[model samples]
Target chain A: MQTLEMGVAEITMRLISVIETDEIFQNVMVRGEVSNFKFSGPHAYFSLKEGEYLLNCVMFNATYRHPSGIKDGTVVKASGAIKVYPKRGTYQLYTESILEGKDYGELYKRFEELKIKLKSEGIFDKPKKEIPRFPKKIAVVSSKTSAAFHDVVKTIKKRYPLAGILLFHTSVQGKEASKEIVNALDAADRSSADVILLVRGGGSIEDLWNFNEEIVVKKVYAMKTPVITGVGHEVDTTLVDYVADRRSPTPTGAAEYATPDLIELKRNIDISFSRITNEMDQKIDESFDLVERSKKRLDFLSPKRQISIEKERTNESFSKMIKIVVEMIKEKRSSLLRNFEAISHSKIVRTTELVPERLDSKMEMMKRTVSNDISKKYLSLEKMEMSLNVHDPLEPVRRGYAMVFKDERLVKSVHELKKSDEIKLKLSDGKILSEVVEIEENGK
Target chain B: MENKKVEEMCFEESYNELEETLNAMEKTDVTLEESIKLFKRGVELYKRCKFLIDSASLSVKEVLENLEKEMEIGEDDMGR
Candidate 1:
C-alpha cells in the first residue's frame, strides 16, 4: 500500500467524480422500507432501509410531491442517481420519482384503519342535511383547471342556470392537496351557498388519496351547508364520500343532484298558469249564473207581465160571449124557417079546391111576412156584434185612448185622482208618467 | 315574503309563493274578488320564474384567489 497525505475535501471530490462516471449508480432503482421521512422547505430527506442496510435519500424541487403512501415504514420503489456529498463526506441518493410498492398494503391499511375509527366515532352515522329543492347558489370545491371542474360547471349550466356558482379552487391530489382541500371546504361552508360540491376526475387510488385524508373528511363533516362528494370514477369511493351528505359517482352527477332542471321548472310554471286561468274562468261563470237567476226572479214580479195576463183574460171572455151570441142567432133562424114551411104546407092542402090565383096571392103574402121576420133578426145580430166590439178591453188603447193608473190601481173616475198625485198612462206603444195638477169633473 | 316584489325575488322565493297561490285558489270557499287577486299574483310569479330560467346565465366567482396569494406570500416568508 502506498501511503500519501490527502486532504479530506480532495478525497471526497475525487470520490464524487468517480461515482458520477459510473453508469451502474446513475438512474438506478432502489426498493426498501421508508424511514425518518421529513420535509425542509422544498426538499425531502429520508432513509430507505432493508434490515441492517440503509440508504440516505434526498428529493429536491418544491413542485414534485411525494406519493401519499411513501410515509414512515412504507414500502416504496424510488428511482434516482447516487451522489457523494463533499461537505460531510457522505453519500446519498438524489431521488427523482417515487412509487408505491406493488402490494399497496400500507395505504389500504391506513384507509381501513381510518374508516373503522370514524365509524366507531359515529361520524358516519350523523344525520345528513336535506338539500334545497331550488338552490339559489352552489359552491364548488375543485381544481380550477381540472376536467372535473369543467364538467361540473357545464352540467350545472345546462340543467339550471338560475343558481350562481362560487368556486373554491384547490389541488385534488399530492402531498399539499389535503391541506388545500380543507381550506376550500372551510371557505365553502362559510359562504352563503345553499349547497357545496366536492368533485374530481377519475384516477388511480394514489391519485385520489387526498380525498381519503382524515383532515379533508373531517372538514366535510363539519360543514354547515349540505355537501355532495364526487371524487373519482363510478367504482371509486373515498372517506370523504362517507362523511358527505350526498355521494355521486361523477362530477356531473353531483351538479345534477345540487340543482333543479330548468325544463322541468318551466313545465310546472305553465301548469300552474293554466290552473289559475281555469279557476278564474269557472268563478266568472258561477257569477253569471247567479245574476241570471236573480234577473228571472225580478221578471216574474214586473207590472208588464201582470198587464199581459189581464189582457189575455179579457180577450178570452170576449171570444166566449161572441160564440154564444152566434149560436142563439142560428137557432132562431132555423125555428122561423120550420114554422114558415109548416104554414105553407097546411094552406096549400086546404086551398086545393080554391082557385090557383087565390093560392098565389096567399103564398106571396106569407113569403113577405117570413122575409120581414128574417130581416129583423139579422138587424138585431148586427147590433149585438157592435156592442161586443165596444166592450173590448184593449180596443180603446189601440185607438189612441189611454187608461190611467195611480198607485198601481186603475183610476176609473175623477174621484180617484187628486192634485199633485203621480199617475201612469198605459198606451199602445209604451207608458207615460204624469203629475196631476188639476182634476175637473164633467158637468158635476 | 309578501313584501318582496316579484321582480326582486329569487327563483326559490317566487316558486314557493306560486305554489301557495295555487293552493289558495283551489279552495272552494274563495270569493271571486279574492280569486282574481290570487290569479293575478300567480301570473306575476309565473312570469318571474320564467324570466329567471329563460334569461339566466352562469356566474362563477373564484373564492380562493386571495387565499392563493396569501399562501404564496407565506411560502416566500418561509424561504426567507
Candidate 2:
C-alpha cells in the first residue's frame, strides 16, 4: 500500500462498481419529499429530502410523462438502481419508476404549458377530415387480442355487415407501443379505406399513456385519411384524440362513427321508395280529380248544351212570331169581313137598286108622255090639215074648175081690173106665176 | 316494357327523377291526356326505382382479398 499508486479515475470506477453490486443499493426503494426538480435532455434531475438530509435523484424521460405529475414539494416513493457519478464524485439514485404521495404540481404545470403551446400554435384548430358517410372499407388499428378489437368487430358486423373490415394488429401499451401505433396509422393511411378507426379497451392512466405521446399525435394530425379514435373510458382524453378527425368515447362508438348501418340504409331506401310510390298514387288521384273537375266545367260550357238552350229560345221566339202573325192575319180577316158588312149595310147601297128602278119608270113615263103629246099634236095638225084641205084656196086648182076672177080678190068684180094687173092661176102642183097679159074684166 | 328507357338510367339519378316526376304529375291543371302520359312515365320511374333498390344487396369482403381484386379493377370502377 505504501509503494503502489492508482489514478483518480480508477478509484472512482472501483467505488461505483462496488456500490452498484451492493445488495442494499441494487434495487432500492427510496421514500422522501421531492424538491429542486429540473428536467433537461430527455432526463429529469431532482432531489429527495428527509428533514436535514438530501439525496440527488435522476429519472429518465422514458420513465414518465408530464401527466404523471411529479413535482417539488410532492412526497413520492421511487424505485430504481443506485449508482455513483464518479466523475463528479457523487452518488445518485437512477429512478425507473415513481409513485405519487402528496401532489402532482409539476406534472400539472407541464401539462398546462404544453396545452397552452399547442393551442396557440393552432395544432388543435386545423380543419378536421370529413368522415365518409358511406364507408365501404374500414381499417381498424387495435390490438387483435384486446376487448376493444372484439367490441369493434362485433358492433360493425351487427350494424353493417356489408362493410368490409381490415384489421391492423399493433401493440397498444408499453415502451414501443407509440411507434407501432404510428406505423399502423401509416399503413391504414395508404390503404384503400374510406375510414380508419383507432380504438382500445379501458385501462389505467399509465397503461394508456402511449396515446398521449407527441409522435403519435403528430402522425394522427398529418394523416390524409380520416381517423376516428376511441381510447379508454369517456373521461380519458389524450392528445391524439384532440388531433384526430373524429373522436368517440369507446371502441364501439368508433366503429359506429366509421360506418353506416346496412339495415338502416335499406330501411331508408324502403321508405323513400314507398314515399315516391305513394306520391305517384296521390298524384294520379289528384290528376283524376282535376280531370273530373275540368270535365264538369266543360259540360257546363259545352256548345251542345248552349245550342240546345239556344234552339229552345229560338223555337220559343219562332212560336211567338208565328202566333203574332196568325193573330195579325186573324185581325185582318175580321177587319175585312167587318168592312164588307159595313158596305152591305150602307144607306147608299140600300138605295142603289131602288134608284135604278125609279129611273127606269121615270124614263118610261117621259117616253109615254112625249109620245102621247106628239100624237095629240099630230091629231091637231091633221085636223088643221083637214080643215085646211076643206077650205083650201087652191081647191079650185085641184078640181080644175074654171073660175074667173079679176084682180085676184075676186075676180067677180072684173070692173076693178086694171090694165096691167098680176094674176095667179091656182093649180094642184103649184101656183102659176104669170103677168096679166090683158085686162081680163070680162067675167065681171 | 314501355319503361325500357327508364331502366337504362343510373339508380341514383333514376330515383331522383322518379320523385320529381311524381311532383310534376301532381299539378292540378294537368289535362287528362297529359295526366295519362305522366302516369305512364311515373309507372316507368317507379319500376326503375324498385328495380334499383331491389337489386342493391349487401356484400362483405376480406381486406387482402378485396385489395387484390380491387387492384385488378380499372380506375373507373366505383364499386365502393
DockQ winner among the candidates? Answer: 1
User: What level of docking quality does candidate 2 show?
Assistant: incorrect
Model 2 chain A scores worst on lDDT over the 10 consecutive residues at A294-303
Residue A27, candidate 1: C-alpha displacement in angstroms:
38
* Tens-place lDDT digits, model 1, residues A1-444: 899789987788789899998885887777778999998988999999866889999999724768866788888888899999877778999999998775455676788899999999899997999999888999999999999999999999998998999999998989999999999999998999999999999876688899988888888999899999988877678999998999998999999999988999889988986786566556445544443443343244333444465567678888888888888788888888888777667977557636677777888887887788778778877887788788775799999999899998889999998899999999999999999989899996
User: On residues B35-66, what C-alpha lDDT tens digit does candidate 2 reach at each position?
Assistant: 55656566666566555544432111244357
CAPRI-wise, candidate 1 is incorrect
Q: What is candidate 1's CA lDDT for residue A212?
A: 88
Complex DockQ, candidate 1: 0.05
Q: Which residues of candidate 1, in runs, are more than 4 Å off?
A: A1-102, A290-444, B1-80
Superposed on the true interface residues, model 1 gives a C-alpha RMSD in angstroms of 18.0
Query: In DockQ, how does model 2 score against the reference complex?
Result: 0.03
Candidate 2 pairs with clashing backbones: A69-A107, A405-A411, A406-A411
Give Cα-based local distance difference scores for all models.
Answer: 0.82, 0.76
Q: State how far residue A28 of model 1 sits from its true place (Å).
A: 35
